[model samples]
Target chain A: MNIIETVSLALRSLRSNNLRTFLSVLGVMVGVGAVISVISVGMSAQAEIARNISDLGTNIVSVLPNFRDSASQSRLLQMMNVGLGREMLEAVPALSSVSAVAQVEATLAVGGDTARATLMGVEPSYSKIIPTDTAFGRWLVIADLSVHSQVIVLSSSIASELFRGIDPVGKQVWVTAGERRRPFVVVGVTEAEEDEPASGAGRQAFIPVTTMVYRLLPARNVSMYLGQTRSASDTDAAVAQLRRFLSLKSVDPDAFEVSSQQALLDAMKKVTIIVTSMLTVIAGISLVVSGLGIMNTLLTAVAERTREIGVRKSLGARNDDIRAQFLVESVVLSSLGGMAGMALGYAGSMAVSKALNWPPAFNWLSVVTAMGFSTLIGLAFGVYPATRASSMDPVTALRCE
Target chain B: MLKLERIVKDYDAGDIHVRALGGIDLHVTRGDYLAIMGPSGSGKSTLMHIMGCLDRPTSGSYLLNGRDVSRMNDAALARIRNREIGFVFQQFNLLPRETLQANVEVPLMYAGLGARQRHRMSADALRRMGILDRAHHRPSEVSGGQRQRAAIARALVNSPSLVLADEPTGNLDSRTGREILDILDSLNSEGVTVIVVTHDSEVGRRARRIINLKDGLIDSVEAAADEHH
Candidate 1:
């Protein structure tokens, strides 16, 4: 008989004993449903984390002098430690740009108004390496470095504190450090922080690093370096290249601690992948258990239909014909469960994503794979029972009570 | 034509090796009606099973239409059963889950006929059995006679050359039994070969030739015209 007719015959027999069929299909449905939903949720969470990391800035990797003794000291990464300097940073061929800033607490006064604020000596590239939003005038340009122009850019808090609603651009600011005083023109105003507002943060101002080195004695810097890669994906390569350059200079790599947003993201993504695979394996086990359920139900069906098998044999059905009929039945049974499970999983992911406020959880490849896998599970588990039914002797089967 | 030469069937009843058929030779011409009669355990059913190609003899050759069916493989024997032979069981062995019309379509399905062709032939068989009105009723929903008629319809659905009936009317009353016997008689008159295996002398008397079996051997042969002549 044609396969279509065989399948139809299988459907009828399955309908005749639907309770057993439903019980078997339920196991597969739950297994496939759990698998699809778990993968979707896992993928959605990874995407969210990557987006958050990219928001902070993807290309920034910073190197700090490993002053292991200063863990209790200041939280600042830029510290005065030996063996890390601008020479090593500039020698790195892969870095698109390198930034070194000198951070020191200096006194600032404008026409009898005084405020204790952090004075940062920075390069023109610092504005690009770190995500800084300009509130008013432009940030420091390359000319600021060439002439050692004492141009200061005030943080929004510092601008609001000193100028109080007045634009600080083109104004003069006096900064005293290391027992010397210098007058610097205010250039621009910058936002408070990159992401959320930090509470109780101090006011700050920026000046060219060259000027800070010349004018401010005891300014212990150009020791910490901040490098930017050509792209976020190149951060690991850039760090490796920077390490190799430091090694060539006879400097111990342990002298500085290296960190990057990309490294943290990669670690987080690795954890997510491991978690997803573990969940998929567990789900696969459940599918195997469900396949056993299918086998049990088919075996029971074969037992109940022993007489019918004999009748068919007496009617001239070959052993192959009997095997095909049962195998077709099993495949139909599993694929039905698979289709239902896919629907359930999609709806499950949708509910989960809605609660989490994530992107839509439509993972088409996983859904298709689960469906095909369930059908294959049916075929694989159907073999033994079909063989048992096919190998039965017609005379004995006909004579069975 | 059907012929059997030195057929023997041995049964292993827990290592005892009971010989069911011992050196039996028989022949039946085309369109002939024959009966093998014996009590239970007399090996009549065993001989009938071999005759219908439902089983293979331990040692011997069985030729149906000049083909050595006894030595054929399982697939080949199944093909022969589909196209050349049919069986009617004592219990009227119809699939209880299916309707009468569907029960009649079983052999045709094995014959690999298409759906429309199977439907047409099954309808024709049911009509000839005079149970077309009950074609949609399941076997349990019909009377014993109607159930036997449905079984008979199924036996003839493939238009096989030989019909093997094992106690075809054993489960029915005398009236219904006679009706079933009339159906078989009409089939024989239409040039179809008929072989019946029964323990009832009255049923054996209806055949053209009757062989009485005893202890796995043919004990007597009753002539066709000698009983009432």
Candidate 2:
């Protein structure tokens, strides 16, 4: 039989038992849908992480206290006691500039509304070094750090949650830390971050490092230091120099960790790739299982249609014609199911990405990979059944009732 | 139109070899009407299957229209069947889910004819069998006689040179069976070769010639003394 006749014949047979057709199609649909959703969600998360890393700037380096040194020590406690000296950072020729990074948990209250926030204390030049964009008002100035001005910059999440529609800048908010509550005026509001949860938690309030160390803390200390290399190519040299400079200052080499932004970006990319591949393999096995379902259905069809096959054979149909009929049927089954799955996976990924606060990924690679996998599964599973139908003896088959 | 010589068919039921057709020789001319009749296990069905080209005899030299088809491959045998033969079964054998018109178009579909030609040919065959009005109805929706007529329509759709009917009227009432016999009478009168395989003498009596088989070999061959078409 020709291609058109064979396809129509297959379709007619499938239509006669629509429940069977639907069940087989449903198996393939679920398999393809899961793979598509997983790949798209993974791709979107990977993209968001890459963008966030790039936003941190390529030439930047972070010098953090190695919390892995002692598992008994809490991160917050170790972070509070960390103090990177200015002399140690300025000694490195590769490091063109450095800024102090410190943090403390504090409660901010405005009239009846109160919210807990992490107070991030940094140098006034931190904004210049890290490209910090404010949603309103202005960033910290040099005079604010020198004069120990009691000013605060709220993150957009905290600004919206604590002050609602009221302009947060120029408003007075009480900062309570270490059994002391003092009024500090809001100077600016930072732009909302992409990775923040939908619940508007993880709020940060930024202030000058000098104001935090002199006025808020009983001891003078900073948590960490952020350094900027003169060029992207100088990032590795700056990281090495910072580590050496710390060891020369009588600090243990294992006590502090220094890493460049590029290293972190590569590590994050590798981790995402590993995670996506693992998920695809898991979803791929489901596709293989659905393929087996298709094979079982087709085998049953061959058994039930023995007489029809016999009739066709007597009507001068070659063995190839019978084989083509069943093969085309399975391919059609998978193609239809695959198309529906693609649409479902697209919508599912979008919904999930919306919940996770990442942009919905539209990668054609995922679509191509899913479609190829589903169709190949159909072909692979269809062969045995098609061959069985084609090889039957007309006399025996007609006698099958 | 067809010749068979020294035809022997054997079946291997695991251990014992049972011979079905034992060295039978037969000849059928063009425009002939013949009947094959025998008791159960008399090998009449085996002979009919061989005659229909649905099975290869264990040892035989069969010639159809002067072509040695005994040694042909599956594809070649299929082509021969498409161009030279048509079949009618006792159960009507129409695809249950398809309309009568599509059922009738099966032979032409295997022949690789285009839709326009297949539709035209099946329509003509259906009209000839007086089933034109019920062309769109499925086999189950039609009466037994109408279903058999549709089967006859399918058998004639490709205009094959020979027609084989196996117990054509076995499932019909006497009146409906008479209707089918009359149609076969007219078809033979129009110079088409017809071979009917049945045990019913009533059906055998209508043929111009009859062959009787006992066990595996032909027992007798007789020309009907009286005939009407």
Candidate 3:
């Protein structure tokens, strides 16, 4: 018989047993739905990480002293004393700008209110390497470092804490470290970064690196150097150049660590892949379970329809016809479940992304893969039952009640 | 025409072999109306099954319309059943879930007819059976007589050379049984070979020829006078 007739026969049987049909396909629907939703969620997290990395400037690279041991720390301190940041800029031609960073803990006294905060000393190029906008006044300029100006830039939270409801620009604050206190005028108040507030963007104060090293914290050493490439695409080359320069300047090749945003992105991509595969495996288990469900249901259906098989056989339906009828029924069941699962998965991903305020990432490849896999599952699980139905003897089957 | 020579059918019931039909020889010409009558376990059902091609004889030479079908495979027998013979069981055997029209269309569907042609032929068969108005009604929704008529329509829809009925009127009242026999009589008059297996003498009286089966063998064959008088 033709496909249409086979399909009609299958559909007629399914329609007569609607609840059984629905129950039989539910496993496939849930499995596919879970797979799709998990894939979309993974893609969304991947995109979020990528966006954060790009937000940190893809063209920027950071070089930090590897202070694994006290010996290396002392060596790194001695290297910092010799102005390694300037030497790095002079050695790497791919680097457009470089900034040195020194950090210390200090108490700030402003209008008789004391707030302890991390004091970061950096060059004017630091603003360019890690882009930030000022909510109030101007950022430190090259002239400010050349003249050892006593000017400070406060994060929005620090500014509010130090000088509540009033603009802190041009106001004097005392930075007391150890037995010395230095007066500095606030130059700018940096805008708040809501997404990454914990990344030292809300409670720190910035001053010229020269002022910090020569005046406030005379014994402090530079902790890290931030470098920017001439173009975003040249970040890898710039990192290599910086690594070579730092290795030549240091006693050990592993004394300094240099990394770019691309390195971070690669690491994040690895994590995303692992997570995606892990979720896929879990979903695969569900799919297999559902495949078993299909097998079980179809076997029961074959048993239940033995008389019908006999009737059809006596009416001239060949064994192949009966087999095709059952096979088509299962395929229809799984494919229909797959379609419904796809829709459910899409909605699930959208709901999760909305709840988490994440961008919804739809992967068409996952959709296609899920659909193809579900169809394959149907065919794979449909074989035994169809064979059983087709192999039944017409005489014995007709004698069945 | 159908011919059977020394047909034997054996069944293995547990370790004991049961001979359901023993060396039965029969011949039926085209347009012949025949009835088979016997008590239960007299091999009447077995004979009907073998005649309808639903069972294979253990040893026999059977021919239908000049084609030897005795040693044919199940698939080949299915083709013969689809194209050469139609069956109406005592239970009506109408698919309870399908409408009368779909029930009639089953054999034609197995015959590989297209949907449009199958519909037309099924409707025509139902019309001929005088149950066209109930074509869309499922078997469960109709009375026993209507269901049997629908079964007859299914049997005739494929236009087979022979129509076999196993107690076609066993589940019906006398009036409905007579109505079904009348339809069978008219079909036989229209040059279609009809065979009925029944225990009811009233049903046997309607056939032109009757074979009484006893203990897996034919006891006697009777030819009746024309009922027109």
User: Which model scores highest in TM-score?
Assistant: 3
lDDT for each residue of candidate 1 in B1-229, tens digit (9 for 90 to 100): 9999998999898969899999788998998889889888889989988887779999988989999888888888888888888898889989987899998988888898998999999999999999999999999999999999999999999989999999988999999998998898889989999999998777787789998899888988886662422
| Candidate 3 C-alpha error for residue A394, in Å | 1.6
lDDT of 2 by residue, B30-63 (tens): 9999999999788998988888888889998889
lDDT of 2 by residue, A200-275 (tens): 3367888888888888876566777888888889988888888887766534676677898889988998999899
Candidate 1: global Cα-lDDT? Answer: 0.84
Question: Which digits, one per residue and each the tens of the lDDT, describe model 3 over residues B1-229?
Answer: 8899999999998999999899999999999999999999999999988898888899988888888888899889999999988888888877878999999998888888888999999999999988899999999999999999998899988889999989998899999999999999998989999999999988888888999999899999999675831
Which stretches of candidate 1 lie above 4 Å from their native place? A56-58, A64-89, A100-127, A135-225, A232-237, A248-250, A259-268, B224-229
Quality class of the docking in candidate 3, CAPRI style = medium
Q: In order, what lDDT does every prediction score? A: 0.84, 0.85, 0.87
Q: Residue B181 CA error for candidate 1 (Å)?
A: 0.9
iRMSD, per candidate, in listed order: 0.9, 1.0, 1.1
C-alpha root-mean-square deviation, each candidate: 5.7, 4.0, 2.7
lDDT of 3 by residue, A1-401 (tens): 68776777778888888888898778899999999999999898888889889888889898888888998889788788426777888888889988999888888889788777788889888888889788999888888888889999988877887798897888999998667799999989899868635433236788898888888886767778888989988898888888787787785789888999888998998999899989988998898888898888899999999998888888898998888889998888888789988998899989988898878997788899889989998899998999999999987888889
Candidates' chain A TM-scores? 0.71, 0.81, 0.92
Identify the runs in model 3 with alpha carbons over 4 angstroms from their true place. A1-9, A105-109, A112-118, A160-165, A176-181, A192-202, B225-229
Best lDDT among the predictions, by candidate number: 3
Q: Candidate 1 chain A, which ten residues in sequence have the lowest lDDT sum?
A: A74-83
Arrange candidates, best lDDT first. 3, 2, 1
Better of 2 and 3 by DockQ: 3
